[model samples]
Target chain A: MPERSRAHEWTPITLLPLNGGPDPARLADSFLTPTSRFFVRNHGTIPIVDPDAFRLEISGMVRQPLRLSLDELTQRFPTVRRPALIQCAGFRRSELARVRAIPGELPWDEEPVSTAEWGGIRLADLLAAAMPDDAARHVAFEGCDDVEREGRRFGFGGSVTMEEAARHDVILAFEMNGEPLTAEHGWPLRAVVPNVIGARSVKWLTRIELRPTASENYFQRRAYKLVDRAGATTDAWEAAPAISTLPINTLICRPRGGERLCPGPIRLAGYAWSGEPGGVAAVEFSVRGGAGWRPARLSEINLPGCWREWTAEVDLASGRHDLLVRALLPDGSAQPADPAPLWNARGYMNNSWARAVLEVRAD
Target chain B: MPERSRAHEWTPITLLPLNGGPDPARLADSFLTPTSRFFVRNHGTIPIVDPDAFRLEISGMVRQPLRLSLDELTQRFPTVRRPALIQCAGFRRSELARVRAIPGELPWDEEPVSTAEWGGIRLADLLAAAMPDDAARHVAFEGCDDVEREGRRFGFGGSVTMEEAARHDVILAFEMNGEPLTAEHGWPLRAVVPNVIGARSVKWLTRIELRPTASENYFQRRAYKLVDRAGATTDAWEAAPAISTLPINTLICRPRGGERLCPGPIRLAGYAWSGEPGGVAAVEFSVRGGAGWRPARLSEINLPGCWREWTAEVDLASGRHDLLVRALLPDGSAQPADPAPLWNARGYMNNSWARAVLEVRAD
Candidate 1:
C-alpha cells in the first residue's frame, strides 16, 4: 500500500450526511464549493511525493518512450488552463444502498465531488511528441497508490480509448486553483480527462501507457462494470465497455431533503451536468411528480467539464410538495425519472432525476 | 485619499487599467472573480481595523440604542448564510466612456463587482428586537472608511426604505466564504443587501440608524445616478435617482479577447444577473451581430442574491465571428442592444448587451 499522506485537509461541517444521493439542502447560493466544504473521494491511500523528484513516464506502444520530470513537462509544453468538474462515478452510490439494503464500497454521503480551475499541459501535445502507432487503441494510467480489498491486491489503474485521450479537452493536470495539486488530490501530477468518469482520471498518476489492448486492471475490468441480474449469467468483465462520458443528470442542492419552505414563491436551485461534448441542452423542473414541467433559468457561466447551475421559482400554496429536477443533454437525453430502473450490483452510474420534499407554511 | 492599494496585487494576469470601454477581448471564463482578482472601486481609503476592537452602533429612532462588539453580535442572534452578488452601480461604467468619454473618477473596467457567501446576523431579526416605530421611513448605513474625492470629504453611506431593510434578505455579514472577512473586504463586519447596488451594502460597516428621511451622503445623493441624455437637463447629476437594483445584464467570459478557436462547435460561457428578487428569466446569444438570437443553456444552480451562469454551443464555420450576449430579467426586462441608447455624462450604470469576437481556424 502507498504511504498515506494528507495533502489538503479542511475543517468538517456538522451537517448530517445524506446517503449517496445529493442533499439539495447543502448547496449555497454560489455554485462554487467553499474550499473547506468540498467533498473528498479516494480509491486508495493518498501518496506523498517530492515535487522536485516527481517524474511522469510515457511508455508502451510509443516509438519514443520518455520519462519527463515535472519541470520539463511544464517548461517544454505550452501551459493551458481551464475549469473542469471531477466527479466520482459512484457519487451517490449510497442511494442504491437505501433502495435494496445491499452492501457496497465507499459509504459516501452527498459529497465526493468538486470543480476547480486546473492548469497543466495538454495530453494531446505530449502524445504528439511521442508519436504512438495507429494501432494503439487505448491509453492506460497508473497511480502510485496500492489497495487490498477482500484478499485481492491491485494498484490504482484505469484506461481510456486513445481517441478520447487525444481530444483537445484532455490534459496532464498538475495544478489546482493555480497552486500545485494538493496531496489529498493527486499532487505533482494527475490525469484530467474532461467529461469522463472520475475513476478513469487516475490521481497520483505516475505512468501513461499507449496499448493496443485496454487495461486489464481490477478497477477497469471487475469493479466498475455493470451487469444484468435477470439473465442469471456471469459474463467476463472484459466484455463490458469502460464507462466514459457522464449522462444527463441533475441534483437539487437547496431546500435539501426533509426541509420546509415558507409558503410563497420559493426559489428551487440545483446543478445539472452531462459528459456529452454538446453541453446541457435544457433543464425542466416539476413540483408535482412531473405533472407539469417548467423550464428553469440556467446559470450563464459555463466552466468546461464542470456542472452548470439552474434555478426555478415555484409558488407553494401552503402544503407538502415534492420538487423534482431533471436535465437534458445537448443530444436530447434526459435523466430517468426513477432510480430503481438504473439500480445495479455495484451501485455505479445512477443518473436519475433528483427529487426533494418541502413542507410549505402559509405564515 | 484612502490608501491607494494597487489593483491586481495577487493575480498573475495583468489587468488592463479601466478605460472607457470593455475591450470585448479580455473576458474571463468564470463569472465570479477570485478574491485577489476582484476589482476594487473605492471613493475613500480602505480603513484598517482590528477585529477585536470593532463595535457596531445601532441607534437613531430605535427604542434601544445597542452597541455590540463583533463577538456579541454573533452570539446574540441566529446566524444566517446567503450568497450575494454586490455590483457597483458604476460597473461597466467604462462602456459609457466609449460614446462620450466622461471625465473624473477611476476608469473602472467592466469589473468593480464580486459575489460571495456571507454569514451574519439577519438585519430583520435585529431590527425587530430594536423596536423601531412604524413612522421610520429609511434605515441608513455608514462605513468607517472616510474618503476625500473631487475636493470633498465624505464617508461611504446609503439608506434603504424601512420595509426593504426589514426583509429577510438583508444581513450584517461578519464572515466571507466560511472565514472571517478579509481586511481588504471589510473585515470585522459589513452589510449585505441583496440585489442592491454595492454602495448601499456598506463595507467596513460601523453604524446603523433609523431615520425619517433618506441618507443625504454624497454617494447616495450625487453619485450613482442615472441620467436621460436625450431630454433637457441642468446639472448632469441632479436629474437622476440614486442607483439601486441592477438591470438585467450579461458578460461573455471565455474565448477571451483575442483568443482563437478552430472552426467546428464553439462553446460560449458567461454570467447573468439582475437586481430584482426574481432570477434572470432568459439569456440569448448571437454570433452574427444580433441578426439571429439563440437561447443559451443556463445553469440550474441559483444561490440567493448571487449571479447566475449561462452557456451556449455554436457551430462556427471557419472565419471571424462577432458574438453578442443579452440577458432578460424575471420581469421580462432586457438590456438595451447598444450602449449608445443608454449613455450618460458621469459614465455610470451601463447595462448594454455584452459583445465579443472570435476567430476560428480550419485547424
Candidate 2:
C-alpha cells in the first residue's frame, strides 16, 4: 500500500518519460511541460499534511514570534498570483555520466524542472507581522524533510538575505493546478521564490527563522556544490555559494533527431526560460548546426516564473540538417556552445546549447 | 421579473450604460474581469445554442464544404490558448458627455471592457482543412442573433479578408476561464481575433462563409464608424474605417481623482494596452501634467491582447498634484492629449490621455 501510494505520488510523463532521469533525446518535445507532467526531485520522504491544521511558525531574531494558521494568513493579507518556473540546480546531471561514471544520486538526465502559477501571501507580509530585529540579516527556511550527506544528517534548509526575501512576487503557495497541495508535492504549504533555484522552494515547510548568519545545514552548506575539476572530487562544498536564479537556457521540443520532414513551411515550437525576474531576453534557432540563426516569436503572455512559449515558421530545404537552439538572458549571457566547458564533479547546473538532428525530404 | 433580470445582468456605475441597454459594469472584484464577468455588447438578442447539435459550416469559395461538431473540432485539431483584451470601441463614451451633451449609445464611463484567457481551435487550422479556392478573398461570419437597425433587419454579421483571418492566434474559442462559454457571453463558440477590434469577435457564431467582399451589415459598415467632425450631430462614423485593434490607451486605476496620499514614496499603479500585435512599446507617467515624465516599469509579462500592468514609485510633497498617464505603441502612436479631438457623433473609439488629481498630506 505504501509503494502504491508512492507510485500515485509520482507524476508520469505522458509523451516520453525519462528512462533513468532526463536525457538529450527528450528534446524533441517543446520544452514547456504542463504543470501536472513536470519532473519532481525529492531529497527525503514526502510528508502528509493537513491544510486546516497547518501552521507556519515565525521565530528567532524578531520582536514577535508568531504562529498563524492558513485561514488567518489568507484573511489578514492580500493574495497575489504569479507564474514562476522552479528548476533544480542539478538539472542536466546526465551530461557528467558521459565523461565518467559518477556513482551516487539519481542519474538525472535533464528532467529536473517544471513551472506553475503560484498564488499565495507574500513573505514580506509575514516579516511585517514578526517585526525582525535590526541586526537580523538572513531569512532561513527549514523543511520537514531530512537527508544524509557524507556521514552527517540534517534537515533540508536554506536561507537568503532579508532584502532578497522582500522582492514583490515571493510567496508561500498552498495550491497547484487550482487544487489543494498533494503529498510528494509539498502538501500543506511551500515557498515559491520566483526566478530562483528550486532548492530554495522548501517543501513541507515548517519554520522560518530570521538570523544574523546563513543557514548551517549539510544540504544548505555542504552538498549541491559545483567544482572546477572534471574528474576530481573535493570537500570544498563550503566554498560554493547556493544557487539562485537560473541562467539562460533553450530546448528544442519537437522534430526529433533523424526524423524526416517533407520540404515545406514547418512551424517550430519550443520553450525558453531564465531565473531572472526580467524573463528571457531572446531565443535563436538554427537549422544547420550554428550556420544561420533566426529569432523565434516569443509568446506575449509572459507570466512571471512561468516558461515562455516560442514559435517560428521555417521553410526547410530537402537535406540532412542539425538544429540548434540557444537562449539569452536579459543581461546578455547565453548558453555555452558545448557542455564540456561546464563539466563539474557533482554534475550540477548544466545549461549547454541544445541541438537536434533531422532529415528533410521533398514534399 | 424582467426588471429584476435586467438588474442582475447589468453592472451599475457612475456613467450611464451605453445603447440604453444592459449595464456595463461586472460583478467580479478584480480590476480586470474574467470572460464570464465581462459586459456583452450585442446589437441583437442572445442566440440560444445547442452545443451537441451545433455545427460550424464552412462553405462558399472553399474547395470543400466542411461541417464540424464541437468535439470533432477540438479533437481533430490542436488547441491554442492566449490572453486577449476585448474593449468596446466606445469604452469611455461618457467622457464626451463632459464636452457636450451629445446623446449617444452606451454612455459607458470606464467600463465595457475586460481581458480573458480564450482557448480553442485556431481559425487557421479550420481554414487549412477547408482549403479555400484560389479566388476566395474574404471570410464572413454571421451570428445567430437577430436584430433590426435603420429600418432593416439582419443577423449580427462581420467579415475580414482571407489574409486577416489567416493570421496567427486567431481562434474560435468555446471556453473561457477554463470553463464552457456562458449564455450571455457567447455560448457554444465565438471568433476571437487577437489585437483586433471587439466587433470582429463575432459572438453566437453560426456560419462562416468565404466570400470575395467585406461584410455589409449595418453594424459592420454603417455603425461603429469613426468620423472626424468638431460640431455636434456631425457623423464621424462614416469618415473612418470600422474600429479593429484598439488605439494605444492608458487607464489610471488607482489614486483616483480627489484622492489623498501621505507625503513619502507613493506607488502608482495602472493599466496600459495597445491594439497592435507588437504590444505596448512604452508607457510614461507624469505627476505634474506633462512637465517631466518618467517611464513606468511595464509588466514583464507581455501577454498578447491583454493590458499590461505598470507601476512607478514617486516621491510626493505636501501639495495638490495632477497625475497623467499615456501609452505609446510600437508604431509611435500615442493616446491623444485631449478627448475633444477624438469625440464624434456616436462617441466611439476614444483613446484620450488619462489624468487623475490627488492631494498629499504632510502627516
Q: What is the C-alpha lDDT of each candidate?
A: 0.72, 0.70
> Model 2: how far is A193 from its true place, Å?
20
Candidate 2 ranges with C-alpha deviation above 4 Å: A1-363, B1-32, B229-240, B331-333, B361-363
lDDT of 2 by residue, A242-310 (tens): 666677776566665667799888777667788665778788889888988888876544555667766
User: What does candidate 1's lDDT look like per residue over A89-195, in tens digits?
Assistant: 87677777677654546655456566665668888889998999889999999988766664776668989998888776688887665446666567778888878
lDDT of 1 by residue, B153-256 (tens): 76688899997897777899877654466656676778889888888888889898999988877777667777655343545665467778777777677766
Report the Cα lDDT for residue A345, model 2.
70
lDDT of 1 at B77: 81
Q: Chain B, TM-score, each prediction?
A: 0.88, 0.86
Please tell me which predicted candidate would have the highest TM-score against the true structure: 1
Highest lDDT scorer = 1
